[model samples]
Target: MNHDGHAKNSRTAYTHLLWWFLFAQGGVIAAILVPIHVLVQGILGPLGIVRVVDRHYDTWIRIVGNPIVKLYLLVLIAVPFFHFAHRLRYLLVDLGVPAARSVPAQVIFYGGAVVITAVTIWVLLTTVPISFG
Candidate 1:
């Protein structure tokens, strides 16, 4: 019975570790890339510092047609989304939300990330192909 208990404990600990690991990865990617994305596209382009004059619909269509660009966009959207989920989860927990500290809370928050990821993958797979041909 004791050995069985130990095994269960180890598995639970491993699951928690996996959640934290994903959160850390998301955080790191968000910190590194999000600012650069915002600066270039949001700030510089709008301010005319980068001169995004040709950034019309057709230009974006061709850009998204490239599989590599699609993958990059997937990473850009998905990772930061997970980062937001992770941060929101902890923030709610810290703010003394009773439900936030529970297993269901983890599921609710991280499950949201999973759902977003699935939608992103689906859209990319279906739309990118259709957009190309």
Candidate 2:
């Protein structure tokens, strides 16, 4: 293979594809898991079909104390947020906003997702005391 500028451009496109692949993964995760979460936690639980008991502080703390549950909550919050950012970015572009398809738009959209993920992680770590003992 010749070392050429075209090859470099191809590599850049490949990298962009990888980023889109991650965005698609976030979208799929949100589409599949969030609806069930909302159905159970939002609609069904509220309707009394799932029977959500009001636990005291210690019991709630223990529930979040589990490592797996903490990770799940992080994914549940963060992935959907990326999906929202992706969709919102495209929506702005489609609505014909000036510079909506520019690099700064991408930064603003995905950066918002990153910020949300950080906040989610901070909240989870502060709230959940996971112990291996």
Going through the candidates in the order shown, the clash numbers are 0, 0
Error of 2 at 29 (Å): 0.9
Candidate 2 Cα lDDT to native:
0.77
**Model 2 misplaced stretches (Cα beyond 4 Å):** 1-4, 12-15, 53-58
Ten consecutive residues with minimal summed lDDT in candidate 2?
51-60
Report model 1's TM-score to 2 decimal places: 0.78
lDDT of 2 by residue, 14-118 (tens): 756766776887888888888877777678877777664222466667777778888988888887777788788889878888687788998998889889999
TM-score of 2: 0.80
Shift in Å, residue 40, candidate 2: 1.4
lDDT of 1 by residue, 1-133 (tens): 2376766655656666776787777878888878987887788887888766335666756777778877877787776676788788779878988788688987888889989888988887776453443
